[model samples]
Target: MDIDLTAARVVLLGRPGCHLCDLARDVVQQVVAETGDSFAEAVVDEDPVLLERYAEQIPVTFVDGRQHDYWRVDPVRLRRALAR
Candidate 1:
């Protein structure tokens, strides 16, 4: 899901032992570096409810409290999302 940076509030749902989640974390950090926008990271396993809710969809990305991407990070879309 593409997001508008002017109003974007991103959250990365991640957990340990997840390669894709690690990659997503890197991508989000890079996006922050290039765009200077803030984002949040939520470790699903840290919260059992979150873990159960997002276990199959680790590394989920949300923009403005809405689901954007999952499983993998899409840099192109992310850049567009962060470009205001």
Candidate 2:
């Protein structure tokens, strides 16, 4: 699948079989459901640049193409960011 990162307001960088990524995905889905924003997932291991930059931060969250959070997704903070 082709993910248009530029069009997505939220981008999730993760790899397969990642526990943290799974948790983050749940949080992201909940937040976006409430906020009516769209999100996309990119496999860090699939892209060299993403893998290099986020290998240690598999569950990274990006809002508007800028880094938002890593390891975990804070619902309150995410709601605040989306309101911006």
Candidate 3:
């Protein structure tokens, strides 16, 4: 509840009733526990533009405002991105 609000900027693009999206959210929560970094969630379905752009890729992840991961999260790749 009192974690650092700076360290990394992450945005998760997901939709309701998507299991993969749920998984991605869990992954981000776990990473936050380990990294003490701030994390935010964005439901792509809320925005027409984002929904249109990522309709196929439900669990899209963006780090520092740039696309970093998608569909499935590669733990090694995620760690590397955070280390940057």
Candidate 4:
């Protein structure tokens, strides 16, 4: 698939209608904006691989390809992660 690698400096996986996911995204966005980081938002249900791996863990955060947090995105920790 054609993709924008730079768009995913921070990856957030979630599904629509998930409150925790919504909350996490908001938290992530705040941290990203503060740190001037690029980000990718993925609806887990849209990708079989991600859906299978993260179906039960809707709001997952990844920093530079490594899992960072889940369920709830921590703004302080996210800021720290992005600063790295």
In the range 1-84, model 4's lDDT, one tens digit per residue, is: 122223588988887899998899888888878888888987777777777777887788888888888888878888888887
Residue 69 CA error for candidate 1 (Å)?
Answer: 0.4
- Rank the models by lDDT, top first: 2, 4, 1, 3
Q: Could you tell which candidate, 2 or 3, scores higher by lDDT?
A: 2
Worst 10 residues of 3 by lDDT: 1-10
Write the residue-wise lDDT of candidate 2 on 1-84 in tens digits.
244455589999888899999999999999999999999998887777777777998799999988999999999999999999
TM-score of 1: 0.77
How many backbone overlaps does candidate 1 show? Answer: 0
1 or 4, which is superior by TM-score? 4
Our tally of clashes for model 4 stands at 0
Local accuracy of candidate 1 as per-residue lDDT tens digits, 1-84:
232322446789887789999999899888877877778887776777667767898888887677779999888898787674
RMSD of each: 5.5, 2.2, 5.6, 2.3
Which pairs clash in the backbone of model 4? none
RMSD of 2: 2.2
lDDT of all predictions, in order shown?
Answer: 0.77, 0.88, 0.74, 0.80
Ranking by TM-score: 2, 4, 3, 1
